[model samples]
Target: MFYQAKSTCLYCDHKFTTTKVRMSKTKVLKRDSDFCIHYDGPNPLFYDITICPECGFAFYNSYRKLSDHQRKKLKEAYISKINVMNMVGERTIEEAIHTFKLALLTASIVNERKFITANLSLKLAWLYRMIEDEAEELRFLQNALDDYIYMMAYEDIEQEEVDEDRLIYLIADLNLRLGHYVDARRLFSQLITGKQVSPRYKSLAIDRWQDYKEELEDGD
Candidate 1:
């Protein structure tokens, strides 16, 4: 399931080989209602971020191409600031989390879109969750939820056409987890009653909303 693929750093043009997981080799053990994947084989999540050994420019699939200004910033801020050579080779789960953290830092440095930052943060949270590190998991989850809120409220997110329903469901679910029951109920109600929401998400939202009401009743 693992294969070595050649990657050229967008910032430095440094060529390196990185490991990638073949989808065929992975079996999904389960999925959290929030759509987090639990894999039976080598988890593909660990290998999503590619770190350029020579330049320390870490990125993921969404950031393969870079503008000239972005490249300059990465070279100056990322390459000059870190020990790039230390990140080469196979990554342990801890090392994988490190790479994602670095990617988040770089994303922040470049003023990346809120959606990308939130996604990277969420992935880091998921990685921490995989290791059962509750503190780190909650920390990153909160970061992600905050960014998701900003993206919805202030930023012009393109996902409005792509997966807005899914995004709404995510916000609702995150609110529920973070104990924002009123906001959760509001978003969940929107998803459940909206005409365009997918049947799958609608069904899931209905179930989660019922559970939330029961929890509220129990709290009373």
Candidate 2:
């Protein structure tokens, strides 16, 4: 989905609020149309692209299927972004964090929005937890869990089973980090029950589960 854009000033690079855009289309009752992605349109389909009124940052909200070439390009883009993230030191950590999130936003649009969103949100949640931002961490962890669920829903088509399982484990880990012991235990239990999940992952889950049990027993 390309739309859902934040406006920006091209000259000053200041971002603004987001606004909705509409699409109009025509359909025939009986016949199939070649122009429609969903085959619901009979003839010409007009679509709206969400655009920034200020800087002309137009994005079309779409769910594009990933091709192998696109995946490779995405990997390259991600690596480059990580390299860029690492370039900043202690002085620029805040800017680095913003850049990292923006890069993740772009990654979310690249055919695997659900997975990217889950991963990004979880990472941010962990970071927030580290900074003692309990409310923010909880919110982001929930976002991560929701996105992970969405990603899991498409596991069959996208070979996302392993990733989904991993995300579950991550969610459990984060929950534990945030002192949500019951939630972490339940999530870890669910993750460990997945026979299709890798042995390594299952082992990790078991280890975490034991640790969690101990923590609960220790009354902290």
Candidate 3:
């Protein structure tokens, strides 16, 4: 179910082939509260980013084009510094992680939106979680939390990307994971009280809030 598809890099206009997974071949094992999917076969998450072999450019759906300034910086920082190697065919988990790391590095160099970086960090966390790498998972989780917080404060999240209810729920969930109990409680409270929040998120927020309170009581 894995195959290669032609991709043209926006940064360098260099055409290349990238591996992709056919979703029909994969069964969904489960999904996390944050909507991270666990698959029974080759995970599609591994093949999300498109990396250009010729210029060492890496990107995904979030970033399709780059400004002149961003292109110049990416060329100097990434294209000029790294040894461009052609990566084709199927990829192992380690190789997939490496590709994601390259994408993260490129996103940083190009000053991509916080939403993009946050999603990348979250994906890294999910990838590490799949391998049971707790340390790396937590590290990327913290990065994702920080980026999401920044996004909430300074960035406008389009409804199509992340609706208001999902955004609040995500913030609450991140705070819960990070042990920011007060923040989690606050956001969860808001989510539960919000009229526009869906029943799914409201129920989740209610359950998590109760769990947090119970944990605090047990600790005391």
TM-score for every candidate vs. truth? 0.89, 0.48, 0.90
Give per-candidate clash totals.
Answer: 0, 9, 0
lDDT of 3: 0.84
Each prediction's whole-model lDDT (CA): 0.83, 0.52, 0.84
lDDT of 1 by residue, 89-153 (tens): 56689998988998899888777878888899888988988999989988988899999899988
Question: Clashing residue pairs in candidate 1, if any?
Answer: none
Candidate 3 C-alpha lDDT tens digits along 97-150: 887899899999888889889989999888999899989988998999999889
TM-score of 2: 0.48
Best first by lDDT, ranked = 3, 1, 2
**Model 2 stretches astray by more than 4 angstroms:** 1-91, 104-112, 155-164, 175-183, 190-196
Candidates 1 and 3 compared by lDDT, better number: 3
Best of the two (2, 3) by lDDT: 3
- Tell me which residue pairs clash in candidate 3: none
lDDT per residue (tens digit) for residues 34-89 in model 2:
01122232211121222333433223333244466655665555434433222111
Best lDDT among the predictions, by candidate number: 3
